[model samples]
Target: MSPFNNTTFTHAVFLLTGIPGKEDVYLWITIPFCLVYVISILGNSLILFVIKTDSSLHEPMFIFLSMLAVADLGLSIATIPTILGVFLFNSREIGVNGCFAQLFFIHFSQFTESSVLLFMAFDRLVAISNPLRYTSILTLPRIAIMGLVCVLRGFALILPLPLLLKRYRYCQDNVLSHSYCLHQEVMKLACADITVNNIYGLAISILTMGLDSLLIFISYVMILKTVLSIASREECLKALKTCGSHLCIVLLFYSPEISLSVTHRFMHSSSHLLQIILGYIYMLVPPLMNPIVYSVQSTHLRVRLIRLFVK
Candidate 1:
């Protein structure tokens, strides 16, 4: 045996999985999975490119939309490699450090997306509630600052997680539940004390995801109130239409996440396949759907995309 044969407290290898017990069918399963990843990447990339090249798209609303696209792209990129690795090549082995890093980025991108949604909510609210001050309130520098703050908020909350896990002992059965690393999923495998980890994870989850969702709801409530206060029905429809794509994107992103959280918490008797599929839905759906929703709903984006293709 070599000198590094023993499993120490510091480092170990983890076997990342793809639908437990269906490993043999993973390649066959990779087909749809690959398609989703490709569409997400291409769609989001196109959104970013459209925003970049069009001068009319440089305003706050479009800027925030581009931010969402970037976050979605990050999310897809972070999770796809390992997912494809598991499904296409049957490569499931990942180092402890690699797992921890993936965990950070996965949560970071998630938190960033949540933050972007929150910002987008505020953008819609400001544009509707105080149209005159909207430009004054959300200038380019301010939007950039808000984006950076969102990234930092995610990094700060999630950074300590991997460090906390590093202190624990993962001495046995080092198989991760999904193709990627998740905080709660990986935490359950730890043989060491995990009370603190559980507490912190719960607190951050509620603070980040819970708080963001609550704020988004409040923003929409206010938005509806503002929209309803309009005198003409036609004008009201026209105004609300601006938010249609954003609303769909929000629902697409959050609904599956809520289901996954519930499955992890209360669905103890749920099938492994169900849980895994829910996890996949949470990871794969939003990025793939957001751009399609925008492309369909926003005439400006649709026309611009058509122009790009024609050119």
Candidate 2:
């Protein structure tokens, strides 16, 4: 018997209906997307280059920043090309296998990004809470181990995606609603029982992304308490400045993800457009904002970037 016979599969459809009189909207969307992609690439590349070339940036903080940049770049690349393809070619159709592949990379990079942020939070916490032991604690070997853990965590979180897809039965409609494949959206297409998939997905989210966010929040809370306890006002202000940018970036990244998850679970159809917009925002905005946040808030990175570009 065919998979479709054994399982229930929903057809993929474009998430948005074409605008009534706006054939030009395609151009509008594509141009802005391309611009954002280019900037994201350049900005993240500049950070990577600076970290590699500047000996001073060999510390744990910059190492985490570099990895975060790499993750952001991966996240942007995974989603943007497919989105651009949809806008430019009107080809939003994705097969079951293709949908699974997209879902894998998107989730992989997303989880990796979250892992990197968690490491960053820990790095900040160490620097603030135990400055004397920070260096030894966050040693190069430790950083390497953390990096490996992030990679492993990403694969672990995404490994079940294909297996889940394999169990689903697809109907004649294979068009995906969004520009790219989203896990929940694709799961919604399944004709077979999706209780297992949904449960596993939620379990992963709670254990990994959700738990990581909570830990990061706790780290910052302790960090703030430590900073306030410092006797030197100047030192306290300097330390606060160091964390402000990261705090903003973390909030920006997690807030949308939490919102999207809540909306997808409870208010999917009505919030489809909002979901699409937030999806793009989460993927693109973080990378675009990273450069600005680091450069403006961290004098060292800002100086290095300026000097490197000038030379």
Candidate 3:
């Protein structure tokens, strides 16, 4: 018997899962997962490097972009180790503390990403509606404060989850759905009354991502109103153009997340395999696509990238 099977409630060791019933294809699956991780890590790193080096990119928009990149990097790094471990070495045992830590970082990064996206929406709103006051309003100190708040908010909100989860007696099944620890998935395995865990987890999700999404939607609506009210067609187009990259990122970041959230909440009869795949998509897609979308959409970033590579 595996040593982890001797798990006790207080010192439980959870077995992380990869694709269910596809153990033989682990090697083949690692290729795409590894590729995505490489791209996300390298891509976000390059974005940070370029933004740091280029003085012209030191505006509020780019500063927020850097925050998003940092969040993506954190999110990617948090999950990739266990994922690769499961796929490459068939290692899936995760201790309770380690699992809790992973769960903390994963959700922390996610919450931070959501906050940063909302901030970016606000940034766009300000840039579009009040162009002259953009720099004045989003000064360096204020931007720094916003970044700090993003970190703090995520830290405060997610720190409680692990503690709450630790209190639960996980004496039943210790097998997790994904190759990494997730709070929702972990909570499901608890044999004790998880009323508080369930409620707290739901509250955190609603307060963080849910609130951010609603605010972002409102910001865009106001942005649209401002754009339509502009007198000159050229000016209106120019204002809307500035928001395109951010809009694409907001969509990319939120779509999979919202879909997965809905699946987990409403679709009780959903396929376990499909839910697992959606979980992967929620974690993988944003980090992988954020940098790509920005690179393709932002002419300035594209030019700098080209110059860095070609020149």
Which predicted model would earn the best lDDT?
Answer: 3
State how far residue 37 of model 1 sits from its true place (Å): 1.3
TM-score of 2: 0.91
TM-score between candidate 1 and the true structure: 0.95
Tens-digit lDDT track of model 2 for 1-311: 33344443343332323222455788787888898889888999999999999999899999999998998888888888887877788665555666678789889988998999999999999998898999989999999999999999899879897788777566534445567777877777666688988999999999999999999999989999999999999999988887898899898889889887888887756655677677777777887888778878888999999899799
Q: What's the lDDT of the predicted structure labeled candidate 2? A: 0.81
**How many residue pairs of model 1 clash at the backbone?**
0
Can you give the lDDT of residue 172 in candidate 2? 32
Which regions of candidate 2 deviate over 4 angstroms?
A: 1-23
Root-mean-square deviation of candidate 3: 1.7
Ranking by TM-score: 3, 1, 2
Lowest lDDT block of 10, candidate 3: 1-10
Q: Work out the TM-score per prediction.
A: 0.95, 0.91, 0.96
> Candidate 1 lDDT, tens digit per residue, 20-97?
878778778989999999999999999999999999989988888898899899899999879999988889888888
Q: For model 1, what is the alpha-carbon lDDT of residue 173? A: 74
Query: Which pairs clash inside model 3?
Result: none
